[model samples]
Target: MYRLFAGIEIPREIGEELQAISKKVTGASWRPIENYHITLRFMGEVDRNTAEDLDHELSLIEAKQMQLTLSGAGWFGSSEPTALWASVEADEDLTRLAERCDRAAKRVGLSLDKRKFRPHVTLAYCKGTPLQEAAAFAEKYGFLKLGPFWADRFHLYSSWSGKGPSRYVSEAEYPLT
Candidate 1:
């Protein structure tokens, strides 16, 4: 079985800017810069044949390249904090791309996410951290303008993490024409 997901690849300069924000925000758990990505669809562990079929189906998605900008910050989970994330400003192209990915996944018998798609790059996963601290950290560095970039391609990634940083390896890339 393989754990897979589709996500946009962030450029190095933007990743560096996010890393700087991570350093400034104290008391909150920070996700490593290498793991920074905006997930489009997550398809959990599946058999090898299903994975191949998913890739073949995803290859047909043709979205026009769009510009994406990192604009704000937010948190996930209530009660006990679960994550800190950098939010993306909503754009038609981003939403359409995500919807196309969803449609592709559904065509291959994968379940579509019931929740509305909200795009963001997870900055941290909080474990027993105070919510107030996390919120404050977000407020302090949330206004960061990481500029913008053209998203020209998306990837089908294989996720792997044991004890250290989570690693995502791209198995296939689909270009947006």
Candidate 2:
């Protein structure tokens, strides 16, 4: 089985800027710069054959390239924060791209994701972190402006869950034209 997702890659300079914002936040595991991406769909575990099917379908997606801008910072989970992320405002091109990815996954027999699509590049995952600390961290770097980058492609990525830094390997690339 393989764990998978589709995401837009972050350029080196933007990743470096995000890396700089990470600091002494207790119980938060800061994601490595290389792992930074704007996830479009999270298609959990699937068998190798199913993964192949999904990849083939995703490659056929025909959409225009998206213009993305990274602005603001926030954390998910209120009382006990679970993640800190840099937000990307929703735009028509981005929304359409996400929807196409969703359609591709569903056509491959993957279950639908119930949650609405909210685009963000996760900075860290907080485990048992205090609420006040999380709130303060959000406030400190709330005005993060990083891009007006063009996303001409997205990738299908594979990852494993365990200790140490999480690394995502791109399994396939799908160009948007």
* C-alpha RMSD values across all candidates: 1.5, 1.0
Best by TM-score: 2
Query: By how many angstroms RMSD does model 1 differ from the true structure?
Result: 1.5
Per-candidate TM equals 0.94, 0.97
After superposition, candidate 1 runs with Cα above 4 Å error: 24-28
How well does candidate 2 match the true structure in TM-score terms?
0.97
lDDT of 1 by residue, 1-177 (tens): 999999998888898888877754334567777788989999888889989999999999988998999998878877766888888888899999899888988988998788788999998877777778777877886786676898999999999978866789999999999
lDDT to native, each model: 0.85, 0.92
Model 2: per-residue Cα lDDT over 41-125, one tens digit each = 9999999999999999998999999788999998999678999999997788889889999999999999999989999999999
The TM-score measured for candidate 1 stands at 0.94
Candidate 1 at 27: error in angstroms? Answer: 6.9
lDDT of 2 at 36: 94
Ten contiguous residues minimizing lDDT sum, candidate 2: 158-167
